[model samples]
Target: MLKDKVVVITGASSGIGLLTARLLSEEGAVPILAARSRQKLAEASSGIAGKHEIKVLDVTREDQVKQMINEIIADHGQIDILLNNAGYGQFESIVDMPSEEFGRMMDVNYMGIVRCTKAVLPHMLGRGSGRIVNVASMAGKIGTAKSTAYTATKHAVLGFSNALRQELRGTGVTVSTVNPGPIDTPFFELADPAGGYTSNVKWLMMKPEYVARKIVRFMDSGKEELNLPLKAAAAMRFYQLCPRLADRLTYRMMNKK
Candidate 1:
C-alpha cells in the first residue's frame, strides 16, 4: 500500500510525473517531488490532498542529485521508493541532430537515473527494504522514427533495470520497470511544436492519470517489468519476429520520428 509511505519522484513537475505525484499523495503516500522547475513543482504540489515535499533538482547534475537524495533521507528518516522518471525526447534525424544534443539526452535520460540509483542503493540495501520504479518507454523495445537518442536512452534504462533487478535479488528491495505506449500527455507537445500528429492514432492513447493509477497498482503487486497497454507489447514482439517485412510494413510507410 502507498499510504503514508515516503516515496521520492523525479521529473515530477509535469505530465506523468505530475499525475503520479498527485495520485500517490491522495492514496496516502508521502510524495517528494523532484524536478528542475520549482514553479511547476510548486503548482503541482497544490493539487494533492495531503502534504508532500517539493525538492528542486536538476537530474543532469550528479552532485545535485547526491545532495538532494541525502537531504530527503535526512529529513524523512527513510526513503521507501525512488521513482526514476525524469526524461525528455528530442525529435530529429540522427544525421542532423547535434552530437552535443545527443550527449545531453544520455546525460539526463540515462546518467540521471544512474546517479539517483547509486545515491539510494546503499540506503535501501542497508535497510533491506525499498522499491525502485523506473519509467521507460515503448521506444525502448521497438524502433521509432526521429527518436534515435531518446530510444537509445530508454534502451539503456531497460538494461539498467535488468541488471539492478539481478543484483538486488536476495535483498528486500524491489525493482520494477514500466514501458508505456503513447499517452495523451504534454510530452508530444513538448517534443513537437506542431499541434496535431497522426502517429499517435494507435491504442486509444491513454491518459497520464490512467498510467499513474496502473503504476501504483503494480507497485502494490510487487511486479517486475510492467509492459503496459498490453496490445502494444504484443505488437512490438510480433513486428520483431517478422523482421524486414515488419519494418517495411510499419516504418517504411510512415513518418520518421
Candidate 2:
C-alpha cells in the first residue's frame, strides 16, 4: 500500500527508525532517512533496498528541520508520510537529573516533533491528504521510576499528537501515535545503563522488527493509536480505570522482571 510513497523518517540511524525504513522500503516506499549524523544515516541507508535519500538533520534545530522539508519537496514534489521518530530516553531520578538534561530531552524529543510537524503540515494541508506517525512510548501514558525527563517529553508528544489529530479532522490529514513498550534495541543500553529494567522485562521487550511491521500496518490502516504487546496495552488500560491498584501492580510487575 505504501509503494512509491514519499515517506520521510527522522532518527533513521538506528533502532525503530532504521528498521521502519527497511520495512517501508520493502513495501515500495521511497523513504528519505534523516538523522543528526550524516555518517550514520549513510550507513543505515546503504543496507536499504531501492532508491532512498538521506538528510543530516537535527530536528531540534528549526533551520535544519525547515531546510530538510523544503529540500524533500523540491526533490520529491510531495511528502506522503512523515514518521517523527527522532528521540532519546534519559532515565534518571528527578533530583539527580540536571536541569539542562531535562531541557535537552524536551527540546529533542518533544519540540523536535513539533518543529518537524509544523514544517510539513502546510504542504500536507495543501495536498489535502497525508499521514503522520509519531513514535511515542507507553511511558507517555504512564509514568515509571527514574523516567521523569523521558516520560515528560513523551507525554508532550502524546498531547501534541492528540490535539493535532482532532484539529485535522476535515483536512484529509491523519495523525497516529505508536505507544511501544520496551523494545530490545540499542536504545535500552542508553536508556537503562544498569540493565536492570531491560533484564527484568527481557521477555516482554518487543523486537524492533516486530514494532516496525506493526507501525507500517498502521500507516495504511490509519489507526489512531497502536500499543504493542497486547498485554501491556491491557495493563495500561487497567491503570486508566483504577489508578491505585494499577500503581501497586506496576511496581510489582517491574520488580518481578
Candidate 3:
C-alpha cells in the first residue's frame, strides 16, 4: 500500500526509525530520512535497496521543520506519510532531575511532534490524504518511578495525538500512535546511564526490527493506536482499571529502575 509514496521519518538515523526506513524502501516507498545529523542520516540510508532521500532535520526547530517540509513537497510533490520518531529520555526521580533536562525532554519528545505535525498538516490537508504515525512509549499510559519527566512528555504526546485525531475526522488525514514497551535500542545509553533499568528489564526488551514491522503495518492499516507486546498492553489496561492494586503488586517491579 505504501509503494511509490513519500514518507518522511524523523529520527531516521537509528533504532526504529532507521529500521522502518529500510522496510518502507523495500516496499517501494520513497523514504525521506530526516534526522539531526546529515552524516548519520546518509550512513543510515546507505544500504537501502530502493529509492530514498536524506534530509537533515531537527524537529525541535520550527524554521528547520517548515523548510524541510516545504523542500520535500517541492521535491516529492507530496508527502504521503510522516513518522514522528525524534525523541530521547532521561530517567530519574523528579527531585533528582534537573529542570532543564525535563524541559529538553518535553521539547524533543512532545513539542517536536507538535512542530512536525503542524508543519506537515497544512500540506496534508490541502491534498486531503496523509498518515501521521507518532512513536510514543508504554510509559505514556502507565507512570512509574524514575521516569516522571519522560512519562509526562509521552503523556503529552498521547494527549496531543488523541485530540488531533478527532479534529481531523473527515479531512482524510489520520493520526496514529505507537506505544511500545522497552525496546532494545540506544535510547537507554542516555535514559538509563547507570544501566539499572536496562539490566532490570533486559528480558522484556523487544527488538527494534519487530517494532519497526508493527509501525509499517500501522502505516498501511491506519490503525488508531498500537500497543506493542500484548502482555504490556494487557498490563497497561489492568493498571488503568485497578491503579491501587497495580501499585501494590508492581511496586517492586516499578522501583527496579
- The prediction achieving the highest lDDT against the true structure is 3
Candidate number with the higher lDDT (1 or 3): 3
lDDT of 3 by residue, 1-257 (tens): 99999999999999999999999999999999999998888789787889999989888899999999999999879999999999999888889989999899999999999999999999999999999999999999988898989999999999999999999999999999999999999899988888988898888899999999989988999789999886788999999899999989999887767
lDDT order of candidates, top first: 3, 2, 1
Q: How accurate is candidate 1 locally (lDDT)?
A: 0.85
lDDT of 2 by residue, 157-201 (tens): 999999999999999999999999899988877888888888788
Cα lDDT computed for each candidate against the true fold: 0.85, 0.90, 0.92
In angstroms, the error of model 2 at 24 is 1.1
Which 10-residue span in candidate 2 carries the lowest summed lDDT? Answer: 248-257
Clash pairs of candidate 1? 4-28, 145-257, 146-257
Number of clashing residue pairs in every model? 3, 1, 0
TM-score of each: 0.93, 0.97, 0.98
Once fitted onto the true fold, the runs of candidate 3 whose alpha carbons sit more than 4 angstroms away are none
